[model samples]
Target chain A: MQDVTITINGDIVTGTIDERTLLLDFIRDVAGKTGTHNGCLEARCGCCSVEVEGDIVKSCNVLALQVAGRSVTTIEGLSKERLRPVEHVTSQSLAGMYAPLEAMGADVNDLHPVQVAFHQCHALQCGFCTPGMVMVMKNYLEENPEPTRDDVRTAIAGNLCRCTGYQHIVDAGMMAAETMRSQPDNSRPAPARPAHDH
Target chain B: MRAFTYLTPSAPTEVVEMLDAHAPDARVIAGGQNLLLGMKDRSDSPAFLVSLGGVSELEGVRAADSGELVIGAATTYATLARMEFTGWHAEIASVCGNLADRPVRTMGTIGGAACAADPRYDIPALVTGVGASLEVLSAQGVRTIEPSDFFLEGGGTSLQPGDLLTAVRFPATEAFTTVVFEKFRQRVFDAALASTVLALRVGDGVIEDLRLTVGATTPRPTVCVTSTAGLIGQPVDAIEPVLVADAAAIEVLGPETSNDPPHLRYQRELIKSVTRRALIRATAIPRS
Candidate 1:
C-alpha cells in the first residue's frame, strides 16, 4: 500500500491506497466518502468533479497519489444541517437535477440552489445527467454569479442528456440564482471550514 | 490501468537520473492533468511514473537577474496566474488565467504545458512572442533553448528522454507592445481546434519588434518571426503586410500532418485573425 495524505471536505485525511488506485476509488472505497461517484471512467462525465484546493476538478481523472498533499472538497462536506446559504445553493443545484438527488452514485439531500431550480423547471426525465449538471452549475456560478445565456449553455454543453432537450437546464440555472437571491444567506461563503494545514 | 512503481524525486537533478534509469519505459508526470487522464483511459501506461511535484525547484516563478521571467517546469498554471508582474505581465497573466478554467489550470504547469506542446496550449506562443528560452537539464548538464527551437513539428517538444525542462526565461524589456490571443475550441477546455497568439513592440508610429506564433494549425507551435528581420523601423501601417507575409512564411515551413486539408484551412484562418488583431492591438498601445 502506498501512503497518501489528502485533505477531504476541509479536513486532511491520511490513508494507504493501492499503487494504481484512483482518487475517486480511494475517496469511495477506503476514505469512506461517497460524495464523488464513478460513472464513466473517462472525464467525459462530470460526476467525479470535486473541489481540490479551491479548484473544481474531475476526481476520476486524477490518481490518489497525485493529490497526496492537496485538499479536496466533496459534496459530503456540505451538510444541510450545518451549511450556510451558498452551500444551500450548491446542494440545491445537485438535488434539483435528479429524482433521488444523487450524481456519480453518491447520494445527498442538501440541495444546491441550482439543483432546486432544475427541479422546479422539470429539467430531467431520466436523472442520469443531473449530478454532473449540478456540479457544472455550482462551479460556473462560483466563477460567474450572473451568467449570460451563452455562458449557461456553454456550462452545460459538455453534459449529455437525451431525456430533456436542455432548455429546462438553462432555465433552472437562472431560476436557482434568482430564487437564492430571495434568501440573503445564499450569497455568503459555505461555512467556516475546519482549518486544514497544508 | 496497470499498477506501476511510483517515484517522487526531491530534486530536479534526481528527476533526470530517475527518468534516464527508467528510460522509454517511465513517464515524467508534472501536473498529471494530461498524463494521469491518459493513464486512466488505459491508452498508455509507463511501467513507472516519476512524479515531479516533489522537485521544489521546478515549481516557482521569478524574474531573473537579466530581466527575464523564469518559470519552473513544475510551476502550476494557478501559481503562474498568481505570480508577480513586470513589464508585459498583464498580457501573459490574462491569457494564462483565462486558460481552461479554475480547475485544470490549478493542476496544469507551464513547463508541462510547454513541453507537452499541445497545439491548443497558449504558452508556446506566449513565450515565443516574448522571446523566451527554456533551461533543460539532462545527465550531460544544462542547456538553454529558445522557444523557436524547443517546439518540434509534431505537436510536442524535441525533449530527449532524460532532459527535464527546468525553467523558462524571457528577456525583460520596457517595450510596451500589443498582444492578442484568440482560439476556437469545441468546448471550454476540450483542446483547441485553432488558436493564435501575436505580440508586437511598437513605437512612434513605427514597428520595433514583432513575434507571431500560431498553435494547433501546425504539428508544433511555430513562430513567424522571419519578417521581423525587415520591420525594425518600418511604419506601423506598413507592418500589417509584413505580418501577413510572416504568416504566409509560417504556412510554408512545416506540412500539416496532424489533420486533413479542411481542418488545416480553419487553422490558417485563426492564424490570420490573431495576426491581424495583434497588429491592431499593438498599434493602439502608446509607445514607450
Candidate 2:
C-alpha cells in the first residue's frame, strides 16, 4: 500500500490505497469524482480518460501510485458550474432543455465549448461515452484547431459510442473545433476551481 | 489486480539496483498501458512495480555522437508523434501517432512496447526491420543487444527479471535511404494482425542494402535476411515486388503443408499483401 496525493479537478485528494488501485478508482472512489466513468477495466474503452499533467490517459490503465503527485483534470473540471441533473431529458424535450445549464447558473461561457457543442449537436444518446468523447475532443481540438471532419472522426476513433452512430459526435467535434478556433483564449478550460481542504 | 509494492526510482541506475535486489518479484512499469492491463486480469501480478516515469535518464530522444538516433525507453508515443523528424526517421513518428488512439499513445512508450514484445505490436517489427539495437542495464552493467537476439522466437523478449531496457538506438538515416511500414487491422484502434516493414538503401541505381521483416503473423518479428539478401545487388527498377514478397512469405511461413490451418493460410496471404505494399512504396519513394 502507498499514500498517494493527487490534485484532482483542483482538489488535493490524499489516500492510502493498495498498490494496484487504478487512477479511475482513485478519481471515482478516492477523489469522489464520478464524472469520469468506469466503462472498461481494461484500456480498450476510452470512458476512463482524463488529463494528467495536460495529457489525456485512460485512468483505468494507470495505477494511482504511478501519478502519485500529479495534477489530474476530469470532466468535472471542464466547467465553472455543474449542470443540475434533470429527471429525464428526452429527445422530444432535448431542444427545450437548454435551461438546465442556465438554471444551474452556468452561462455558455462557463462551460467548455465542447460540452456546449455536444448538447447543441445531440452528440450523445445513452451518454455513457459523452464524458470521454468530450475530454478527447477537447484535447484534440486544442492541438489541431482546424481539424477536418475526417480528422475529428480519427481523433475519437478510440472512444466508442453505441448510440448516435458517431455522426453527431463527429459533428459536435467539428463545431467545437470551429468554436475553439474563434476563441483562442478559451482553448483550455478555465483555471480549475480552488482545492477544497478536507 | 493483486496488491503489490510500488517503487519509484528517479534514475536509471537506481531502477537497475531496485530490479536487481527484487529480481523475479519486481517488474518495471513504464507507461503501464500494457502492464496494468495484465495486472488487472491477473495474468501478471508482480510483488513490486518499479515505475520508470520519474527516471530522467530514460526519457526523451537525442542524437548520439555516433550519429545514431538514441530514443530513451520511457519516451511516450505522444512525445514521438508530436516531434518533427527528418527523412526516413519521420516514419517512426508516423507509426507512433497512427497506432492505437490518442490517449493510449499518450501513455504507451516505445520501450514498453519492445519490452512487452507482444507479437501484434508494431515496434518490434519496425525496430527489427531497421536493425536497431536495444540498450539494457542489469547488475552486471550496460550492454547492447541486437534486435535479432533481444526478441525471442515466439512471443516475449530475452530480457531477464533484473534487466532494464534503457533505450533503443536506430542506425543513422544514411544507413537506410527509405523505410516503410504497413499493417492490416480490422479496426483503426486494433492491433495489427499482420505487418511488414521494408528498409532499403540504394547506391548507383542498385539495391545496396535491403531488410524485409514480417511481424504479427509470426510469433515474433522475423527478418527474411536469407530471402532478401538475393535482392541486394539487383537493379532498383528491376526488383519485382510480387516476386520479392512471395519469397519472403515462403521464407517466414515455410513450405505450404497439406494440413495448414485456414488462419495460417490467411496470415500468409496477409503477409504477402502487406509486404508487397511496403516494397512498392519503398521502391517508388524518391530517395534522399
Candidate 3:
C-alpha cells in the first residue's frame, strides 16, 4: 500500500491504497464520487474522464498511486462550480472560470451552458457519456472560447458517444462556445487555478 | 488486472539499481498508456512495476551541446504538442497533437511510445524520420542507439532486461526544409492502418536531403532509403510524389518469400497511397 494525498474538488484528501488501485477506482470507491463514471474500464470510453493537474485524462488509465500530490477535478466538483458561479476568485481559481457563463446568459439556477446546450440540443440520449463530454468541453471551451463546428468535433473526437450520433454534441459545443466568447476580455482573469497545481 | 507492487524512484541511477535487483520481474512504466494496456490483457504481469514519473532526469525537453534536442523519455505528448517548435519539429508537434485524442495525448509519452515499439504508433516513425536516437542506461553502463537499431520486432525495443530508456535526441536540421506526417485510420482516434513521416530539404531547385519513413505496415518504422535515394539528385521540378511512393511500396513489399501474400499486397497498396499523400502534403509546405 502507498500513502497518497490528492486534491479533489478543491479539498485535500489522503488515503492509503493498493499500488495497483486505479484512479477511477479511487474516485468511485474511496472518494465515493461516482459522477465520473467508468464504462469501458479501458481508456477507449471517455466516460472516465477527469481533470488531473489541469489536463483532461481518463481516470481509469491513471493508477491511484501515480496521482500522489496532484490535484484532480471530477464532474461533481466541476458541476458544483458551474452551478454556484463563483464571481470573485483568484486569477488561477477553477471556480472563477464560470464568470463567463454569466456573460453568455447562463442561468446560475439551472444547468451550466454546456449542460444546458446538451439538453437543449439533445446531445445525450442515455446520458452515460454526458459527464465525460461535459468535462472535456468545459476544459476545451475555456481554452478555445470561439470554436468552429469542425474545431468542436476535433476537440471531442476522443469521447465515444454511442447515442445522439455526435451531431447534437458538436452543436452543443458550438453553442457553448458562442456564450463563452460573449464576455469582454477584461472581465476574465487567467484561468482560476493555482500556479503550482500543474 | 493482476496486482503488482509499485516502486517510484526519483533518479535514473536508482531506477537501474532497482531494475538490476528485480530483473525480469520489474517493468519500467512511464505514462502507462501502453504498459498498463498490456498488463490489463495479462500479456505482461510483472511482479514489480517501476514508475518513472518521479525521476526528474527523465522529465523535460532540453537542447544538448551537440545541437540535438534531447527529449526526456517521460515527457508527455501533451507537453510536446504545446511546445513552440519551428521547421521539421513542427511536424512532430502536429503528429503529437493529432495522435489518438486529447486524453491519450495528455498521458502518452514519446519515450513510452518509442519503447513500446508498437508498429502502428506515430512517435517511432516520426523520430526515425527526423534522425533521432535513444539514450539508454542500465547497470552495465550507458549507450546511444540510433533509430535504425532501436526498434525490435513484436512491439519491443532493443532495450535489454535491466535497461531503461532515458531520452530520445533529435538532431537539428538545415533550413529550406519541411517535414510532414500523415496517418490514415478508420476513425479519428483509431490506430493507424498506415502512417507516413517525411523530411525533405530542397535547395537551389534541387533535392538535397530526404528521409521518408512508413509505419504500421511492418514490425518497425521502415525507412524508405531506396525511395529516398531515387529523389536525392533529382531537381525539385522533376520530382513527383507518386514516383517516390511506388519505390517505397516496392521496397517495403519484396516479391520474395511470402507467408501471407494477400495481406502483404493490400498493405503495399496502402503504403503507396499513404506515402504519396504524405509526400504531396510535405512538398506543398512553403519552404522557410
Name the candidate that leads on TM-score: 2
**Superposed Cα deviation of residue B101, candidate 3 (Å):** 0.9
The ten-residue window of minimal lDDT in model 1 chain A covers A189-198
Sort by TM-score, top down from the best: 2, 3, 1
Instruction: Provide the TM-score for each candidate, comma-separated.
Output: 0.80, 0.94, 0.88
Q: Put down candidate 3 lDDT per residue, A38-104, tens digits, no spaces.
A: 9997888889999997799988888988778899988887544345434654435532453544654
Global CA lDDT of candidate 2, please? Answer: 0.87
Better of 2 and 3 by DockQ: 2
Question: For candidate 2, lDDT tens digit of each residue in A1-198?
Answer: 678899998889999888778899999999899989999778777998899988999898988888889999999998866666655565456546645555444566668988878866778877898889999998999899999999998898889888889988888887787777777876354322322222
lDDT of 1 by residue, B1-288 (tens): 878899989998898999999998888888777777777668878898998868888877777787667778888887777665755766677777666755567678888888777776777767766667889999999999977688876556878888889998866756445666666676675776656666666667776776666666667666665545576688766666445734544563444456547655565665666566666566556443
Worst 10 residues of 1 chain B by lDDT: B245-254
Q: Candidate 1, overall lDDT?
A: 0.69
Candidate of highest DockQ: 2
- In candidate 2, position A136 carries an lDDT of 93
User: Docking category for candidate 3?
Assistant: medium
For residue A167, model 3's alpha carbon misses the true position, in angstroms, by: 1.1
- Report the lDDT of model 2 for residue B134: 100
Worst ten in a row by lDDT for model 2 chain B: B279-288
- The deviation in Å at residue A164 for candidate 3 is 0.6
